[model samples]
Target: MSTRRYILDTNVLLQDPLAIYAFDENEVVIPAVVLEEVDSKKRNMDEIGRNARYVARLIDELREEGKLHLGVKLTNGGTFRVELNHRSFGKMKEHFLERTNDNRILAVALNMRIEEEEKQSGITVTLVSKDALLRVKADALGIHVEDFLSDRVVQYDRMYTGYKELSSESKQIDELFENKKLLIKDSPISNSYPNQFFILKDEVNPSRSALGMTSKDGNYLESFVSSEEPIWGIRARNVQQRMAFELLTRDDIPLVTLAGKAGTGKTLLSLAAGLYQTEDLQKYKKLLVARPVVPVGKDIGYLPGEKEEKLRPWMQPIFDNLEYLFNTKKPGELEQILAGMGSIQVEALTYIRGRSIPEQFIIIDEAQNLTKHEVKTILTRVGEGSKIVLMGDPKQIDHPYLDEYTNGLTYVTERLKHLSETGHVKLQKGERSGLAQMAADLL
Candidate 1:
């Protein structure tokens, strides 16, 4: 078999700084233009900037092995080269333009393909990029292309739903309800994971049903502790919501992840549970809420105000939920209430670093916009008696480099789904309103 060459784009490196090592034994090529773009992004104050710095450092260390311009051998038995030649502009058509960095990178791949053809080497030169437009352009220019697939955990369709439904006999359902616990070891259901929820239905009498969550031992199925009680006047409207409430109200499960579409009550339910645990039960000293400050549409220019005023627009939805829970009507009444309580705090995800929070109920909303590393940092900040809830809709990710499968919320859920101290529930039904549910389903 002939060797294959992979030309990586700038976005691929910024998305995964160690992407060069993921090509197996294939030869890796880094276009000089990609280096320029990455260098320009090193000063950014976001995750992309951090990844850019890491890539730069990695390349610099690789320089110690030998000159990068000339090829250096990687540990994986592949040659790595920094391509400095961009003289293949005549190979591409007119519409691609010659001055852009993307075109320059394309020129490098075109040159490699031309060289392979001239030498009769029978080598395949493919462009690996994360930009869909760049991949299309490469295909138009007759260059083979692929997206960076190293970071994608699973396809959206095959993602874990955190629950399952099983049909059983009426007697079995009654046993689960009466005894409150049943062993599922010899049951036909296979591969039952820990912390997974289930909806058991009676096959003989389809009307009889019960909800159960698998024990940490993955042996017994236990009924929910409390699903009938309301949290801060918010009752569980559906079975999924009741399951989520069971996990949220538990003191033993320190981490909980809720995922669903818009209008599924992910945020509202999490906030209600946090408030109840902190204010009513006195389980924690403070209720802290924070979310990533990702922009949906065009970002308004910097506003002039203090911390609360600057955060007002971004935190408005949270304040709205709090107002609904408190049933406050007058303007500024919610603020006055929060101030008098002196236990609730709302801040941005940017200000949460370098702080140790103990005895607090922390809610990180819109967490699907965070990176895996950012999520790890947030989870590590959980001090002695703190409980952190991560809730987000994977389909509504706003981060430029994240998708449904690669977001931090999905990453955390997949990694910690089987842990004894963690619980997860994927809400299926949207209970906001008829119109909202229709829009969420259709739009």
Candidate 2:
């Protein structure tokens, strides 16, 4: 087999700082321009900045082993090098005239490709980048390119939906309802996961069905008991929502993940469950809601306000759901109510680090924008007694380096699907409104 060389782009390192060690036994090359880009972003306060600083520290540590310009031996038996000589425009000047960092990175890959071919080394040189446009340009330049795939948990279409439809006999459905728990051995379910929901349809008559969830031990199919009344003035309009409600209200499950498109009531359902548990059930001491401050389009830059005021714009979507839940009529009424209650708190995910959150119903909205590392950080902070609900639409990710398959929400859903303490649901229908559903479906 021929040895393969992977030239990583700056965005790849920013997306995953440990990307250099991901390719097993493959020569990893980093263009000097990528280091310059990382240096420029090292001062950022967000995740990207943290990654930039991490990458710098990693390279500095590797520098002690050997000269980076020549090559350094990686722990995985792979060679790592920082190419400093490929500064010429070379072939890229004929195509892209711009002298951008992307182009400079492309130039390094193109030069390597030429050198490999000329030497008849039988080695493959590929550019590993997360930027789609940069990948296209590399392809146009006759250089092989691929997206970083180590972080991806599963394909988007094959992502776990947290539930399954199994054909069962009417007797089994009746047994589940009568006893409130049917042993899986006697049922049609040959395989199951902890906390997995099921819609068991009768093989003879599909209309005869029952809703059940797998026990924590996966030994029995337990009946799903849904709330008969409204929760914080919110009712389950669909089966998925009902499933979400069941998971949200469960005191045994410590982690819940909900994935769906906009208008699917992911945020509203989570908020309603949090409020109900905090205020009505008194199961949790407080209800804390937070979301990443990722902008859809261009950022408005700095805003003039205090901490709470600065976070209002990013947390407005959460407030919108709170308003509906509280049924606040007049302006600023919801704020007053929240202040009077003192149990509900809304904040940004930025300050959630370094704090131990206990006895709280924590709802993380737009969780798809979070990276796996960030999600881990958040989950680790869930002190002794707390439930964290992470809800987001995988398709609507705003993170530049994240896709439906690689986002933190999907990562957790697939990785922890078999765990007893975690529960997940992928809401299929949008209960927001007809227009909202239509737009979510069409747009």
Top candidate, metric TM-score: 1
Model 2 C-alpha lDDT per residue in residues 299-410, reported as the tens digit of each score: 3357887888888888999999888888889999999999999998887887777799999999999989988888988999998889999999998888887888888899
Model 1 pairs in collision: none
State, as a TM-score between 0 and 1, how close model 2 is to the true structure: 0.94
Give the Å error, residue 348, model 1. Answer: 0.7
RMSD to truth, every model: 2.1, 2.3
Alpha-carbon runs more than 4 Å astray in model 2? 186-190, 295-302
What is candidate 2's CA lDDT for residue 424?
96
Relative to the unseen true structure, what is the C-alpha lDDT of residue 260 in candidate 2, on a scale of 0 to 100? Answer: 95
Give Cα-based local distance difference scores for all models: 0.87, 0.88
Provide the TM-score for each candidate, comma-separated. 0.95, 0.94
